[model samples]
Target: MNPVATWRRLLAELLGTALLVTAVVGSGIMAATLSPDDVGLQLLQNSIATAFALGALILTFGPVSGAHFNPVVSAADWFLGRRTGTGLSLRDLAGYTVAQTIGAIAGSVLANLMFDLAAVDISAKTRTGTHLWLGEVVATTGLLLLIFALARSGRAAVAPAAVGAYIGAAYWFTSSTSFANPAVSIGRAFTDTFAGISPGSLPGFIAAQLIGLALGVGLLLALYPDVAAAAEKVVIPAERAARRQRAASRR
Candidate 1:
């Protein structure tokens, strides 16, 4: 319940997400442009690049933040008893989401500037396609499962590396090559560039991911009976700031 611990976790997640989004979107774009001959192979290469970047980030910040740069992972961790215990309040959610959004936008912006990427409209996501939807399902489920297993055995120390490897493997198995983070998925929608999913198809793809995440949680519950002890409640943005103000006032 320490304030310092909360702050450190917040900062760590922000840093990790910033690095993650940049590596994911940036490398993805580069691969697509550099190897337009084979879209599938380019995407696979990009996935490997993302994995390595993520692995490095985790090793750097995992101890400080548990390196849960994704909301899903953080929420899952809280559900499974891995939260830092200052309490995963709405304040945490607000802080985390704000940072994540900024990081995603900035990452996309940087990628655009660096690679001459086109500005894709928000509504363009509709073309994500059925294959992408299937990919999201498989990728997200695999990601969550990897996180759950690594975290459960106190092997969380190596979570970043383990997570990166899962992603690399998932890329080969899934057709869409995995857009696991919702924020990143939405951000990628803005670029009509090589990595953008069709805005119209975003909903279906996201839905599949949500279902996959649910299934993953169910599997973990059965496999690791103690996982629920880590569940963290989703904090509504507006409510969290007020709660923090009140807590500070009390102090």
Candidate 2:
């Protein structure tokens, strides 16, 4: 990719991720503040906000950077593209991941600042145990499956709504409330709030998410082998435009 294009994509990833984390952390704080006595209401409020914000963010940034906003999704795209040479290059993958992580952290800090709290604080909420890990696995597996399956089925256009809806539902259903994204998980660790997770518990959550990612890839391979072409359309708008141009030239 050209330097300008690469920079644009990176900026998209960073800004998208930062906004996403801000939604997650900020909504959690707002919900907790407003619904101090009702845990269920707090969760409901937070989940709704996150779902809406995610969908909007995806719609805004999907055309520019694919709107991954998650490390696992980016890695999945890289892995799927490796064979067909239609996805992100190794260098691009690295850039996306780094940008996402930084964005996530910045988002956490921004949310804290918005609430007049410290910019960075270690979370005290300790989310652990086998059941939680299992929850993480299920949440992440479903997330990956939904993403890749949509890509394979030529329904990438609906990703904004579909992904946001799935995540919103997962929040209520999953025991861990679906911290499926490693980058998001790390960001949440920086806040000591209703949605925060303790730093010590980060490893287990990330490991489970990785396992889920693997399972998602395995299932996609087993069921949608022919849809590898669709996988190429997961994101990366520049490539999509290039492909369209090539087709236009042929016509």
Q: Which candidate leads the pack in TM-score?
A: 2
Question: Model 1 Cα displacement at 193 (Å)?
Answer: 2.4
RMSD of 1: 7.9
Poorest stretch of ten by lDDT in candidate 1: 232-241
Assess the local accuracy of residue 215 in candidate 1 as a C-alpha lDDT between 0 and 100.
Answer: 77
lDDT of 2: 0.87
- lDDT tens digits, residues 135-208, model 2? 99999989988988877665677888999999999999999999899999999999999989999999999999
Shift of residue 244 alpha carbon in model 2, Å: 4.7
Model 1, TM vs. native: 0.78
The TM-score values for the models, in the order shown, are 0.78, 0.93
Candidate 1 global lDDT: 0.66
Question: Which segments of candidate 2 are over 4 A away from where they belong?
Answer: 1-4, 238-251
Q: Which stretches of candidate 1 lie over 4 Å from their true place?
A: 1-8, 82-87, 118-126, 229-251
